[model samples]
Structure formats: C-alpha cells, structure tokens
Target: MQKKSGLRGIHAGWYAVVCVLVLGLVALVLYGSGAYDSWRDGRSLDQACDGALAQDGLTSALGSSHLKAEDGDDGSLAGCFVKTSPGTGRAVRVTLRWSTDGAPSGSLVWYNADTLGVREQAAPLGNGWSGVVRYDGTWQIMVALDCANQKNKALVAYGDLYGASSGTALTGLGRVTTETAKKAAAQHGCQVKAGKRLTRVSTARLGEPGTAKPLGQAQGSCVALRDVPGAQSGTPEIMEYPADPDAPQTNCYLATSAKKPGYGLYAYYGAAAKDFESVGFGHPGGDYVLATAPCPRSTHEAAFALYRLYDRDTGNYPVPHYSDSFARSALKAFAEHEAEQRGCGEVRIMSAP
Candidate 1:
C-alpha cells in the first residue's frame, strides 16, 4: 500500500511539470510572433493627428504591425509623416495634411495628381462623404467637410501615398482621411455634416475620352454638353460624376479626340466656391469663361468655369482654336444644366475678358 501511494504521488508531480512546460511554450510562441508587440504598438499612430488617425486594419494593409509618426506643421496646415517599421523591405510612407484651405484655392487646371503618372479623372467617394480619389501608380484623396456656422470655410483632409501600395492600402488611406477629417472638424468646433464609416470606395481611374460614346448617342455625363457646336463631328467623349447635387464639387471633361481633352468644366459650391474666389480663380478673363448661380447649400453664389484645353508641351490652345463663340455657348449650356441639376436658379454666365 505504501509503494502504490508513492507511485501515485510521483505521477501527479510529472503531470504538473508537463502543464507548466506547455504553458511556457505557448507564451514563447506568442512573443515570438509579435502578437504581444502588436498590442503594445496598436494605438501608437493615433497620437500624431490628435488621435484622429485610426489604426484599425492598417497593419494588414501596410504589412507591418509596427508604425510611427513624424508630426509636422506648415503655416496653418497640420501635417504628419506616417511610416511602416524601420527596416522592412516593403514599406509605406504616407504624408497627410489638413486645414481649412488645404484644397486648391485657385486653379483653372485643377486636374492634379501627387504621384508620378498621367492624371486621370477622380471618382467621388459616395456613402455620404464629400470627397474624390484618384489613383495612378499611387493614390491621392481629398475630403471637404462643410461647417454649419462657418459657411465660407471647410475642413479639408488631403493625403497621398508615397511608396508601395495595394487595394487594401487604398482603402486604408481612405479610412485615414475620413477619420482625420471628422476628428479635425470636431476639434475646431465646426458643426460639420459628418460622413458615415468608409467601408469601400471606387478604384476607377479613367483618363482621356473616358466612358466614350458617339456625340449623337450622348447620354449620362455628355448629355448636357451634346448641343455644343460640332456635336456631329469626330468622336467626342466626356467624363463626369453621376448627377449628385449634394457633392461640394463637380467635374466634367469633354474630349473632341480619342487622344486629348477638349474642354474642362467645373462647379464649386459652398466652401469650395469661397476657396475658388479667394484666390482669383473665378475671375472672368483668360482663355476661360465664368458663371455664377445661387445654391441652397451656400450663403454665397456657386461659381463655374469653362476652360480651353491646351497642349502641355507648347502651352498653346488646340489647332482650329475650337472657336471662342463655341466656348461661350458651351459654358452657358453646361452651367444652366449643372445649376438645374443642383436645384439652383438662373445661371448668370459672365462675358469673357
């Protein structure tokens, strides 16, 4: 009986030793896989933008669980440089800036891209967010949030990726911009119309002659511009957003050839309109014509412009001059059509200077 009892005690001691060893192994695995580090570094990136940039799903997109921020400032603009782990072969570097005047205050040529690629038409990020995204080799996003009391200004979050990227990375960038804009608006005491959580966005990057159709068969975006002169001529194409009035800005690019853009029409409402006029963009002159109409969303009038297309190399207007008379007629038609779509009244087209 004594020997049997001793054997039972020995077996219990061995069982306890095995349990401890197994637990130690499990802990070693967790630590080695960096699961512990992930928890520690999870909220690190949020510190830069005043807790505006959410780190959720960014780790997977960036392919690193570790991130750091180098905070910066430029005049009134708040900026940040976000990077992946220090020594990773595949790294992502994103620079973000936000301010009331971050967007272009004045430019007839507003088709801009941060990355090194041909500029393509940007698509609107729907789901109640007033923003547009363009992807070339890299991506750029701009979100304009309207203020309730400060009608003349808006909080704009603009950001672009600098290095390696993927579809997930694009979505992650959108998340960063959206979250930062919302947080900044709140901090500045702007009762802004908040956007919903961004789950998905369009990746379409259409270049010249986008979504083309014969002018005779014009519909959708080109329908409003169909009555312009030479509608029955060589293939003309257009690119535009779907009829959406709540959007703060609208773009329409009309191309007379398959190779190049012909005319660029733009509408700026609310804060964007203010930004446009503040920098002498909406002034009637140059190779472009201007128009204005009152909009419900803005305390001031919305501004529109029709710019003549030119060759980048020579900086000269296209051959045949495309006619100034044609430009005026086209501007009037496009302005009236766009104003009507936005529920605005009486577009007052300005004479060319």
Candidate 2:
C-alpha cells in the first residue's frame, strides 16, 4: 500500500511540474503577442516629443523599424532623438532640434566651419525647402520654415544622422525632418506653408585630394574668378558648388594645387549671416573682405565673405593671397548674381581691408 502511495505522489509531482512549464510558456506568448500591451516599451517614436515626430522617413533610412525615442526641453531649446533598438545590425542615431531664435550659438559656429570651409560641401534641400544638407563621415541637415502667424519666430530644424550613407541619409533624414517640421508647426498652431514632399536631397561632395579641377576649366560659382590674373597663374584649382539662392549658405574654395592650402569665398544668409557678423574678428568690411545685401524675402540681410583657409593641422589662417580689389570685383559679380536669384536689393561691397 505504501509503494502504491509513493507512485501516486511521483505522478502528482510530475503533473505539477508540467503545469508550471505550460503556464510560463503561455505568459511568454501573451507578452509577445502584445496581450500585455501595458508592459511594452513605452518610449515609442509616436509618443516622443509629444507625438511631434513620425516614423515615415526613418524606418527605411535606418533599415530598422524597432526604434526608441527620448525627448528633452530646456526652455530655449527642445529636441528629440531616435535610435535603433539594441542588437540591430543597422545602427542609426538622429537628433532633431527646434528653436525660435535660430540654432544655438555653438551650432552656428559648427555650421560655419563645416560648410564655409574646404572640408565639406553644403547643398540646398531642393523642392522649395529653404535648408542645406551636408555629409562628412555622417549626415547633417538644417531647415528653416517661415511661420506666418508666429511673427519673428521661424520653425528651424537641425538634424544629424550617424551610421548612414549619403543616399539613404539624404532621402530619409530630409523626409523625416520635413515631416517633423510640418507636424510641429501644425501642433503649435503656426501658419506655415509647408513645401512639397521631398524624395531626394542635393549632393554635397566632400573635399578630397583628387576632386579639385583646374580654375581655367571651373564651373558654377568658381567661374566668377576663373579669369582673374592671380587665379590664372600656376595650377590653381577650384572646388565649387553651383549657385543656390535657396540654400542658407554657399561656398567656393581656391587651391594652389591638389591637396594644398587654399582660401574660401562664401555667402551667408538669415541667422547665419547675423551670427557671422556678431562673432569676434568675423565682422565684415574690416579685417575680412565682405559684402552685404538686403534680402527682402528673408527676415535678415545676406553677407558674402572672402576669407583665408585655416591650416588643416593648426586650424589657423594660412592666408592665401590674390588681390583685394580684384577679389572684390569677382566677389561682387558672384554676390550680385546670387542676390538676383534671391530677389534681394543692391549688393553692397564692403570697403577694402
């Protein structure tokens, strides 16, 4: 009888063990199927930034749909950052910032360094979007959308995409930024005429040793200085982007030879121009050769500057020479052409240094 009791107890124990295993499996299946939705990751893209951002452009760009978001607000600045979940082979981190007074001071400085210098090129985000896109080991974009109702307050978006290439970066980040901007505008009750949807962004070629072409055969904005006597000598090469009045800034680089030191000729508009003028030693018409124009369509004036290239190693000016008067003439031609495109009044060249 005792033996029989022992067998029965063994059967009961085994049954209890099986029941526990099955219950655990059922719980896991319920969670995976979202039956326990409350336990899911709460920080989703739709919930980030009070639902100001969307996953439309980011999913394909980052090659992953499993994303997480974190947002922050610091009175003057607000931002939302999105990234892929851990263990995803496709890694991406994108941050979008919103501000009424333009980008932060540090961002303006970085923009000047990245776009105006010879390191990277800046291209206009076309299709009526007043913004610029650039790439240098990563992608950077800044867009300014005017708000009619919110006078003196334009909705500006600054986006940075890491671990993504040019094609996907431009298309994906550009679309996402535009979408977010429009959404934010609507949510804030700002009357903004959003631009047409963007499928692609312009190409911004980075400066490299083999990319410089002869000044004699230069095209785009560099053509203004192609015939100058100083630029005609030696194997002077030019790195240039086509004139883009839609862009906040434009640039031209002149190199004595391939991979050698050079100088920069650039134009800044809107808040960037204001920032350029406010900083130390960056004032126009004094130490630097510059010109100003009244941009009627924009809230701020436009500035065109000719400045020395900073040494790659030391980050100090090597100060390439050409002739101030000749340079001024070429710059005037360049500025006038751009001003015409922007529908701006008189291009006022600054006094010689």
lDDT of 1 by residue, 1-353 (tens): 99999999999999999999999998899899987665555555766665666566466446676776656444344666566756454433333333345443212234332111124345667678877776555667777777777755677776666567776767777877777777777887777887777777656554533454455565544567887776445326665556555666676666656534566677777655766666576443347788999977666688887776555655654433656777777778888887888788899986574
lDDT of each: 0.64, 0.66
Structure candidate 2, residue pairs in collision: none
TM-score of each candidate structure, all chains considered together: 0.73, 0.77
Give candidate 2's error at residue 264 in angstroms. 0.9
lDDT of 1: 0.64
Runs in model 2 deviating more than 4 A are: 1-28, 32-43, 74-77, 87-102, 111-117, 149-152, 164-166, 202-204, 227-229, 259-261, 278-287, 313-322, 351-353
Q: How many steric overlaps are in each model, in order?
A: 0, 0
Which consecutive 10 residues in model 2 have the weakest lDDT in total?
279-288
Q: What local lDDT score does residue 110 receive in model 2, on the 0 to 100 scale?
A: 48
lDDT of 2: 0.66
